[model samples]
Target: MTGANGVPEGFVPLPTSAFVEHLGGLYHAPEAPEHTFGMRVGPEHANVRGRAHGGFLATAVDVATSRGARAAMGDGSGVSTVTMTMDYLAPVDVGEWIQLVTTVDRVGGRTVFATCRVTAGDRLVARGSVVLARIRPRA
Candidate 1:
């Protein structure tokens, strides 16, 4: 079960609350704890032309940004996505596990900035930046 890096291969890397639970639709990072999101590529999320859908890429970025903010703020941080911009660099094939890395650039009293990248086997498939606003919990 060792992966290429010597880590256990095929082992679900993320927590149960992360992506696998959602059937590759969503995922979260435990180290960040501030964010939770998931990504999908390959055939399950491809377009009719057989390329990864642009909308899915954007959603992944947005989810990562929001989850990262949540991780930073902790439970009940009341963060919400305000804006997201994504750039599709290359086409991705089905069955390839797309890797997503999200980083929180800044966390202010009212806003958060995050960046994420989607890659397939060392090739960049998409990249994005997202802005989120922190709000008060609903009554």
Candidate 2:
């Protein structure tokens, strides 16, 4: 079930998030399944200038960071991104395969912090960090 870039079929490891699906973002799951995710830039994900939009990039950042936090904390309850900061290093053109490498920085009582480095092959796309709050377990 490998795709053009060798990503397995239905690679998106996380739950079917509305926004992530809207962006056509998917990840490499059942393989690494942690701390890393990827997406192929599509027309819908592009801005008027035919490049990746800031919102799309930011959403990818949030998604990857959240997944990383979940992997590190091993809490299936869920992770809510509280805050995020992104710095666009370069523009990603359409049809490029982008990968986000995320790391969980720390886990507090309820907050988890993580960072991600985005790249398209060898090109830097953006760098970002996010803080996520662990969802409480339901009774």
Candidate 3:
């Protein structure tokens, strides 16, 4: 099922900062844990070259995979990216709805490792991996 704006049915808009809100609305897919994050590409997301900017895509991946890692922490803990790498496979055009499909590779006491594939429809547009440091509350 899909939403009115073509967003998938299970996805709900995620509250974000002004910068992210301007980039494009972020979505959380609660029903599909693997597909925890998503966003729709708009003309504003395009670069001067008329494709989705690499920086924007990188930001989306970082946010999405960090959410995956945080969920793996299993204590409602937050996470900060320790390191991240992204490989651009294809150019995503405006009007494409992209999904960030993530896998939690490993979970440890202080760190989590995860990978995400950015897909636009049937195309795999990018892949990213991240190592996140668990952010525990100061006690």
Candidate 4:
């Protein structure tokens, strides 16, 4: 199945083991029109207070937004996050799966704007916007 934008539906951007193995660094983008992704927060990702680290939350949003933009551009395009702004609304506990939902707000010749939300279960943990620049393939 394809999303309204025509990308394959239910496609995971990363494999399950990829998230499990990475511990502190893992992300998955499940296929959707909203361009959703998620990461499992492990003990290593927690802060001194034992909650998910703010940096990890930001990283998850950045990665999810970048991948979502790339998916919107289709195969063979490379994109990187040029800027990201995140708001922490709530704390994310360790051992919980944080879902990142991204939407391609705009796509221009060389730039893509995206918005993402991070949630643990039904609670909003963080939200952000990412500006990505498309880079030409290396020669």
Best by lDDT: 3
Predictions in order: lDDT: 0.67, 0.81, 0.86, 0.76
The stretch of ten residues in a row with the least summed lDDT in candidate 3 is 67-76
Positional deviation of residue 103's Cα in model 3 after best superposition, in angstroms: 1.1
Evaluated against the true structure, the overall lDDT of model 3 is 0.86
User: Higher-lDDT candidate among 1 and 2?
Assistant: 2
Residue lDDT tens for model 1, 1-139: 3357422333234443445345454544455333434344646668889977887677667666666667666747767788888889998876665667777898888888888888777898888988889885666
Runs off by more than 4 Å, candidate 2: 1-15, 29-34
Which sequence of candidate numbers ranks them by TM-score, best first? 3, 2, 4, 1
Judged by TM-score, which candidate is best? 3
RMSD of each: 4.5, 2.8, 1.7, 6.4
Give, for candidate 2, the lowest lDDT window spanning 10 residues.
Answer: 25-34
lDDT value, candidate 1, whole model? 0.67
lDDT of 2 by residue, 1-139 (tens): 4576655465654565887776774675546554678888888889999999999989888888887777777756579988999999999998787888888888887888899999988888899988899885777
The order of the candidates by lDDT, greatest first, is: 3, 2, 4, 1
List runs of model 3 lying over 4 Å from the truth: none
Evaluate model 3: give its TM-score: 0.90
lDDT of 4 by residue, 37-135 (tens): 766687888899999999888877877787778877785678878888889999988877787888889988788899998888889889998899887
